[model samples]
Target chain A: MKKFISVLMSALIVGTSVFMLSGCGNGEKQQELNVFNWGEYISNGEDGTIDTIREFENRYNVKVNYTNYESNEEMYNLIKESNSSYDVIVPSDYMISKLIKEDMLEKINFDNVPNFANIMEKYKKTDFDPTGEYSVPYDWGVVALVYNKTMVKEKPKSFSVLWDKQYSGNILMFNNSRDAMAIAMRLKGINPTEITKKDIDVASAYLKEQKPLLKKYVMDQVFTEMEGDQAAMAPYYAGDVAVMMSNNENLDYMLPEEGSNWFMDSMCIPKTTQNKELAEKFINFMLEPEIGKANIEYLGYSTPNQKVYDLLDEDVKNNELNYPKEEYLKKCYTFSDLPQDVYDYMQEEFLKVQA
Target chain B: MKSKAPSIPYLIWMLLFTIIPLIMVIYYAFTDKSGNFTIQTFKDSLFYTDVFIRSLWIALVSTLLCLVLAYPLSYVMSRSSRRGQNILTMLIMLPMWMNFILRIYAWVLLLQNDGLIDLAVKFLGLDVPLLGNAGAVILGMVYNYLPFMILPIHAVMLKIDNSLIEASKDLGANKFNVFRKVVFPLSIPGIISGTTMVFVPTASTFLVAQYLGGTGDKMIGDVIENIFQRDKNVGSAISLVLMVIILLFIIVMNKFGDEEVVA
Candidate 1:
C-alpha cells in the first residue's frame, strides 16, 4: 500500500512537472501543431481506419504533436498553469463555455475552415456557444439506461426505475457529481440548468434515498459490471452503451422518455495558438467527410457533421441507441457552466450523500 | 555535523518537494478559492464526518485483522528453522511483486456476484451478496497490507536474543510464561511499527473501496479525491483533518505499546 501511494505521488509529480516544461523542438522547418484531445477519441489506423494525425502531418508537411487528457478540468489546468503550448483541444460543451468565459479560446476563421458549413445547423448554435464563434461541434451523445435483460424482467423506460427497491444492489449510477446530481434533479422534475442550492438539496435527498440500492457509484466500472452480468442496470453515455452491448448480448438500452443529459465535445484552438491558420486548417481536415466518418465510427459516438453522418455505414447510421431520434433529443438537456458557488455547493452536497 | 553534510541532498529534496507541498496544503485548508483567509473550507469538510468515520473504521478493522493474522504466523516463522523462515518470507513477499491494481481487480472478479467465491457460496446453498459491501472493502485492505504486518513482526521476533527465553524458562517459567514475559515484550516494537504501517495506509487509500465496495462504503480518501477535482480548498481541509486524526491515532498507539511492554 505504501508502495502504491509512493508510485502514485511520484507519477503525479512527474506528470505535472513534465507538462510544465515547454519542449520547443519542431526539427528543421517542420511546423508543429499541438493537438490535445481525449484519449482514444480519434481513429489511429487500427482496424483499417484512418490515422487522422498521421494523414494531417503527411499532407501538410507539418509535425502534429498530440497529447490526451482524461477530463476537461485536467486540460484546463494544464493550459492555465503551464507554458505548454497546445494549438488545438477537444473540450466538452460546458468546458468550452467556461474557457470562453475565461477568454482562453480563439475564434476560428471560417475562411480557413470551409467545412464548418457541413456541420448540422443545430450543433452550430448550441447552448454552450450561441454564436458558434469559439468552437466547432465534433461529436454529441445523450445518457442511456443500459440493463441486462436477463436480470431486468421488464424493459426500463424511466429514470425512476433506478430507484426501485427491487433492483437494490444491482444498479450502478454515475460517480461524478455533475451527472449524478443532474439526473437526480431531472427525476425530481427540476430543470438541470442554472442549478441552485435548493435544487441541490432536493437532488441530494433523492440520491441519499437511493444510495442503498446502488451497487456502486461508478464511471468506467459500469462497463465491467453490466457486461459481466454483475449489475442489472446502469446509466451511462449512449456511445459507451453501444460498446457495452457489443460486449454482452444480454444488454440493451433505453433513452428514458422523461429526459436525460446530453453532451457535446467540440474542437477549438486556444487563444494562445502560435499558428492560427494551421490550427484552423487542421480543424477543417478533421471535418473532412471520410476522416470524420472513420473517426466517429471508431469512437462509437454520433457525429455532428452531416457529410460524416451520410458517409457512415448503413447499420451504424441507423443505430438509434447511438444516435437517438430528434424528438427524443428534444427532451435532452445540455449542461452549461454553472456559477462557481453553486457548483461547489452541488459537489459538497453530493459528497454528503455518499457520506 | 557529519550527518548534516550526508543529509544535505535529502534535506533540499524534502524542502522543495515535501515541505513546500505541505505548506501549500495548509494554505489551501485555511483559505477560500479566491485566496481569501477563511475556515469555510474546514466547515464544509464537516459534512463528510460519516465518510471520515467509515474510513477510520475500515482502516481499524483491516489493521486489527492484519495483527491478529500476522502475530501468530510471525511467531511460528520466527521459531521455525532458517530454511523454513526463508520460504515463509518468500511466500509473503511473492504477491506484492504483482501490479497492485491488477490484484485489486482480480479480487473484484473473484468476489462479484456469481464470481468464483460467490459460486462456491451458492453451491453451499447460500445467497449472500459477496461484493459491494464493507466486508469486501475490508478484505481488500487486509489482503494488500497483511505482508507489511507479518514482515515487520517477523524481523523483530528474529532479533530477540535466544538467551532471554531460556533465562525465563530457567526461572521456572513454563512455555506460556516464557512467550508472554519474554518473546512478546521484545516483539512489541515490531508490532507497533507493523500496526502503524498497515493502519495509516488503510485509513487513507481509496481505490480498494472503489473497486470492492458499494456506494455506501465510501471512505474519506474517495471523498477527498472526488472533491479535489472541484474544490481544492475543501479537499485540503479534509486532508488536514484526516492527517490530524491519523497523527492522534499513532500517538495513542505508541503510548499503548509502551505501557504494554513496560508493564
Candidate 2:
C-alpha cells in the first residue's frame, strides 16, 4: 500500500511538471538563433557604438538569442551537456581543438559564409582548425608583460624579470591556473601547448619559487593595480594592457623575447545547433568589415579581418600593443588542448604550489 | 488542528531543490565521471588538506575577532535608549545598503599601499605591507562578518531583564560579579548563535583572500571552484568532506552549549 501510494504521487508530480513546462511558450513562433559569446565582446549600441546584434536581427527577420560565457571550459561544458542548444559559440583555439577532437563542433559550411574571404591569409590557416573547417577566426591577441615605466626603470624584454627580487612585493601574477602555468612553462623552456606531467612539475616548482615575490594573484584586479600605479609589473593580455596604458601614461608593455602565449577566440557552430544556416549567416555578418571594425574598436582586441585593418585609423593600426608585428608572431606559440591526465596533473600541482 | 496541505507546496519545493541536489552531490562524491563507483576522488581531495586547514584557521581567527569586537558593542547597543539603538543599527546596516563587492573594493582602496590605512600607519612610523598577506584576508573577513555577529547577540542581549542585574546588585554583588554570575551566563545562547553566524560563512568564503591576500593564501573553496571546471567528482568529494567537518563542528558546538541555549 505504501509503495503504491509513493508511485502514484511521483507519477502525478511528473505529469504536472510535463504539463506546466509544455505551457511555457504561447506567443507566435518566430525563427530564433542562439549565439553564445564572451561578455562585453560585442558592441551593443552603447556610447554611440553600433548595436551588432540589433543590426543582425534587423537584417534577418529572425530574433536572436545571445548569451555570454566567461571561459572556454564553461562554454564547452554547457554545449556538451546538450540541455541548451546554441547556434554559435566563440571559443578559443585550444577549446576549438578539444571540441573537434570530441566531434562536438559542426564543420562550417563556407558556402554560406562568403565573408570568410575577408579574413587575412595569416589568420586563415594555422593551428587548432588547420583546414578552417570547424571554426571562424573572430579576434586574436597575445600575452605580454605590462609594467609600470617609472618603477621598473628598464624596458622588460623577458619573462624572467617577473622573478627578479628587485620588484618583489610589487609584482602580480595571473590568478588563473592555465595562464600562470603557461608562463612558468615558457620560462622553463617548455612549450605550453605540448606539456607533460614532468613538465608541469618543473613549472609548478618554478611557480612555488616565485610565489614569495608576488604581491597577489589577480584577474581583473590587474587593471586596478597597474592603472593605479600600485604594482610595478604584471603579466596580462596585450589588448587589455593597451587599454590600461591608455588610462595610465606611466605604463608600458613588453612582448617577451623568448616567446609568449598567442591566443585567438573564434566562432563555431556546435553539432547540437538547431539553426545551422542562421548560424553561418550570422558568422558571415560578423565578418563584414564595418561590423568587425566597430566590434574590435569597442572591444579593444586585435582583429583578424583584413579589410577592417585597412580601414583602421593610422595610429590604431600602428599601435603594436594591439597589433604585434609578424616577427613577434613568429616568437609566439598558441596553446592547444592537453590530454586529460596532463591537464588534471597541472591543476592539482598548481593548487599544491599555492598551498 | 492544522492542515498538512499548507506545507505541501513547500514540501515539493524542498524535495526538488534541496533533497534532490543533496542526493546528486552524494552520488557525484562517490562516483567517477562515467558513474563508476570510486574512492579515487576522495584520495585526490586529500592533496588539498593544507588549504582546508588554512581556511579553517583563518575563519577561526576572524570569528574570534568578531566576537571580541561585537560582544561589547552589542551590549552597549542593547542598553541604549530605543531611538539611540535604532540609530546605531542603522549605522551598522548603512554600509550594507551599498553593493557587497563595492564595500570590499572600498576596503581594498583603504588597505592598499599608499592608500588611506597604509599612509596613516606610515605616518606613525609603522611600515607593514598593509595588503597581500594572511592578516589582510583576516581583516577583510572580520570587517565583512562583524554585523552578523552583532545583530544576533544584540537581539538576545535586549531580552536580558534589567531587573536581573539590579537584583544581583541589591544582593551586594558588584558590577563585575553581577555580570559574571548573571548577565554573562545568560548571554551564552547569543554567543553560540553569533559564533555560528560568523564562523560557517567565513570558512567557506572565497573572494576575501583572492582580493586581499597574496598568492599563497588560496583557500579550499577556491580549490573546489578551480577543480569544478574540469573535475566535479573530486570537487564534490572535497565539498562533501568540508560539509562533514562543518557538520561535526556545529554538533560539537551545540554539545558545548546547554540544551535550551542551542536551537
Candidate 3:
C-alpha cells in the first residue's frame, strides 16, 4: 500500500506536467492581441450574449487573448516581467501616470482613434497623463460607503462613520494602499493627491484603531460582505454599490460628504507591444458608442463616452451611484502619483496596520 | 555487481524541475531591481512579521485539523473488509483526480453567500455565514489534502500486525486503551509524513486564503504571491525566510519524533 501510494503520487506529478507541457506548445500562431484587465469587469459572452472581445475578434480576424488581474499592481508586474507584449491594458488613473513616468506605455495616435470625440468632457484630461498622450478613458466610478439600511439607524454621511466605535466589527474598508489612505485623508480634510509621509503615518494609526471595529478589509467584492450582513458598511466602488443595493433590499450607498477617491480606468498600449496598429484598432472598437454602452450597461460602471452615457437606460442615467450630483463631485479628487519616498512610507504604514 | 546509477533522463528531469527552480528563487531573493546583487532585499523583507506569523498559524491549524479528521477514517479503512477498503480508497482519491483549480472553484460555488450552502440554509430558514472564516480555510485545506493524510496512515495500519492487537484485547485492554497504547503510538511515522505533506502545501498555497478566507484571515501565501507577482523582489526574500522556517520545522519535528521513539 505504501509503495502504491508513492507510485501514484509520482505518476500524478509526471502526468500533470506532461499534459500541461503538451498544451503549451500548440498555441496557434496568429495575429494575436493580448489584453489585461480586471476580472468580471468586462462582458465574456455569458448565456450566449454577444461580448466585447467576441465582436472584436469577428470584425478584425485577430485572435484576442484576454486575461485578468485582481489589482493594478498585479497587472503592472506582468507587464514589467516577461515582455509578454500586452497590446492593451486597462489601469486606473494613478497607475496610468506611473506607467507613463516609467516609459512603459506607447504614445496614443489620437488620429487613429476618431471615436475619442465620444468621451465626456470631464474625463478628457487629468493630472495623470495631462496631455492626453497615452491612455483612453474606459470607465469612471467613485469609492463610497455601501451600508445596510436595516442594520444602522442613521445614514452614513462621512468617512468618520466607518471609524465610529458604535459599529464595531460591522465595518469593512478597502485593502489597497491608495483607497485606504484616501478615506483617512478625506476624513482629515487632506487632499488625497498631495498626501505626505506624516499624513500616511497619521492615517495608518487611524486605520489601526479602526481595524478592531472592522469586520474585514475588502477589495472588489466589498458588496458580498455588505449584502450577506457580515459588515454593516463597507467602502466599495460606486457601480458595485448599485448592484449590491439592487440585489439586497437592505443595502444602500452614500457618497460621503467629505468625499472619496474617484477613478477612471483607461486603456493604454504597453511599450513592449509589437502589434501597435491592432492595439489601436481594439481601442477604437471599444469606443464605438453601441459597444461602449453595452459594456457600461452590462458591467454597471459609468461610461466615459458621452454617446454611450446618453444611450444608457433611464435608471442607470439617474442612478446616483453612477452619476453623483455636482455638489458631491466638488469634494472628490482624482488620485495622483505620490513621490517615491511618500509611497514607501505609505507601504510601510499599510503593512503595520495590516499586521 | 549489478549496481547501475539512475538513468540520465531521470537525473536531468529532477535537476530541471526542482533543483534549478529552487536555485533561481534563491538567486532572485538576493538581487535588486537593477539586477545588481544586494543584501538590502533580505533586510527589507525582515519587516513583514505579520505575514510570517499569520501563515504559520494557518498552516499549523490546518495540519492539526487534517490529523484529527484523518486518524479515524484511516483506522476504519484499515480494519474494514477488502472490498469495502478498495471502494472507500477510490472515493477518497476521486476528488483529487480533478484539477486543483477546479476543486477550488467548486468550493467557491458551494460557499459563496448566495451559493449552494447559503441556499440550503435559506431553505431550512436559517442565516449564517460559513464561507468566510477560519473554519472555511480549514475545510478547504482538509478537503484538498485529506487523501495525503489517509493514504499514509492506511499504509502504516495495513502493515500493523494483527496478533499484537488481538493480544492487547486478550489482556483485558478495551478498544480505546488498545488504540491509545498500541495503534496511535505505532502510527507516528505515518503521522509525520502526512502532517508534513499537508502542512507544507497548505502553507504555500495562496488561492485558498485569498478567495475562501476573509480579510483578517489573509495568509503568508497571499502576501508572498502579492509581492512576487507585483515585482517586489523583497517579497522573494521574505519567501526565502519562510522556506528556512519550514526547513527548521522539519528538522525539529524529525528530532523530537526520533527522541520519542527512543524514549
Candidate 4:
C-alpha cells in the first residue's frame, strides 16, 4: 500500500511540473506581438484616452510589446542582424523602398486590413509602393523651417535664410544626409532624387560652406536644442515645429518658399515576422478613425486617415504646418530609394567630409 | 592517484561563452556575404581608412585625462583617515555603480545647450557652448573612468610604505621632489593598470560620442557600430578588424610603456 502511494505521488509531481512549464511557454506565445516604432510617436492611452495599442489588445486579446528606434537605419540594421520577430515596423517612404528592395519586408495583404479605404486618396498609390501592397500610411508631414521670432528681425520664409551669413553660428541644420541634401537640392532648384555628379558636388560644397555657420547637425533632439534657445533657426519636421511652438511662444513654423521634403511614415510587416495575422489586426486597429485621430492629436502629427482628419479639432485642421496651401505642396518633393550604387557613393562621400 | 578534472559542464561553459565567440569572430572576419566567411571581408575592413589611427588617438586622450584627474584624488584619499577614506572611496565609486546608460543620459542633460551648466552660464551672463563638442566627449570619458583610475592608485598608495616618504624627506627632498622621485615611481603599476582599464573601454564606447560629440567627433567605435547596426553588415569582419587594431595598439603601447619603465 505504501509503495502504491509513493508511485502515485511521483506521478502527480511530474504532472504538475509539466503543467507549469506548458503554462509558462504558452503564456509567452499566446498574447504577445512585438512592435518597433519611433520613440514618443505612440500614445500609451492613459488619462482616460484610448491608446491604439489598448484598442488592439481589447479586440484581439493580445498584449503588445512596444519598442522604439530613433532612425530608420537603426531599425533596419537591428532587424537584419538579430532574428527580430517584430510583427510591425514603422519606416518612412524611402526606407520602405530600401527594405522592399532588400527583401526585408513582407508584402502585406490588404484583404486583412479593411480600413485601408479610410486613408486619404493622395496617400494611396505613392511612388514608394506602386501597388499599395506592402504598407499602410500612418502619418505624413513636411520638413519645414522653424525659427525663433525673438532672434530674427524679419520673418524668414525661404530656404535661403539657412545660408545667410548673418545667421551663421546660430543656425542648426538636420544632421541626416537625406534631410540635409533635400534642403540643399531644393535651394539649388535641382531634383532631390535625380543623381548627377555635379549636383552632388554642388550640394557638398554648399554643405562644407554651411558647416561654419551651423551650431551643430542634429536629429530628433533638435527640438530640445531649439527649446533651449541654442539655435535661432532649424529645418525640422512640421509636426515637431507645432510642438515646439506650443511650448515656446518665441518659436514660429514656416513653410519655406524653396520647397521642403514631404515624408510619409508607414506601418509594414517584415517577412521575418512570425505573427502575421495578429500584426494585420493591430494595423487595422490603428486605422480606426478614433484610434488614428487620437494618435495624431496626441503625437501631434498630421494623420493620413481621411476619416481621422475630418474629426480633428478646428485649430489643428487650420494649422498651416499641418495643411499648407496647394502652391507649397507643388514645390515639395518625395524621396525615392536611390540606386544601391548611388547610395554607396553618397555614403562614401559623407564619410569623406567627416574624414 | 587520479584527481577528477573540472567537470565537463564547467569546461563547456567557458568554451561556449568565450572560446566559441572568439572563434566565430575570427572565422567571420575572413568571410563575406555578411554571414558565411570570405577573405574579402577582412581585406575590406582592413583597408578602411584611418580606423586604427583614430581609435588609438581617442584611447590615448582618454587615458591621459584619466591619469591627470584621478592621481591626485586617489593620493588624497590614501592620506585620509580610515573612515574618511572609506567615505571618499564610496563617493568616487557611486557613479560607477549606476547604470552606464543612465550616467551617459545625465551627461547629455548636463552638456546640452540650455542644460544645467548652460543655464548656470546664462545666469552668470557668459556665452558658452560646452555641449555637443569634442570638449564634452573628453570630459564625459574622464568623468566615467575617473573612479577606475582612483581606486587602483589608492590601492597602490595604501600598500606604499610610509617610511620611504619619511626617508626621502629626511634626505632634504621637498614635497614636489618627494612625489616625483618616491611616490610617483612606486605608483607605476597602478598607473599602467588604471590607464589600461580606462583607455580600453572609453575607446570602445560610442554612446558618449554619439550623444555629446558633433560631426567631427566620430570615433572608431562609431564606425564599427554604423557598419554593424546601420549598414547591417554581418559585423564579423568589423569585429575581426577591431580585434586586430586593439591587439596592435596594446602590443605597441606595452613595448613603449615597458621601455619607459626601464629608463
Tell me the docking grade of candidate 3: incorrect
Q: What tens-digit string does per-residue lDDT give for candidate 3 at A116-197?
A: 9898887788778889989999998888788888878898778899889998767788878878988887777678888888
lDDT of 4 by residue, B126-224 (tens): 887777677888888888888888888889999888899999999999999999888987887788778777887877777677777765677767767
Name the lDDT value of residue B75 in candidate 2: 95
lDDT of 2 by residue, B47-90 (tens): 88989999999999999999999999999999999999999999
Tens-digit lDDT track of model 2 for A1-355 = 9999999999999999987777665644568999999988898999898999999998887899989988887788889875898999999999999999999989999999999999999778868998889999999999989999899998987999999999988889987778999998888889888888989889999998999998888888899999999999999988899889989999999989988999999999998899899999999999999999999998888999998998899999888878878898888888888998888888778878876
Instruction: State the DockQ of every prediction.
Output: 0.61, 0.58, 0.17, 0.26
The fraction of reference A/B contacts recovered in model 4 reads 0.31
Candidate 3 stretches with Cα past 4 Å from truth are A1-36, A43-50, A56-70, A273-278, B1-7, B28-58, B94-144, B167-185, B202-216, B230-233, B259-263
Compared to the true structure, candidate 3 yields what TM-score? Answer: 0.81
Error of 1 at B20 (Å): 3.1
Candidate 2 vs candidate 4, DockQ winner: 2
Taking the tens digit of each residue's C-alpha lDDT, what string does model 3 give over B153-180? 9999888888989999999999899988
Share of reference contacts kept by candidate 2: 0.85
Which candidate ranks first by TM-score, i.e. highest?
A: 1
Full-model lDDT for every candidate: 0.91, 0.89, 0.82, 0.80
Superior candidate under TM-score, 2 versus 4: 2
> lDDT tens string, model 1, A182-273?
88989899999778899999999999999988888888888888889988999999999999999999999988988899899999999778
Better of 2 and 3 by DockQ: 2
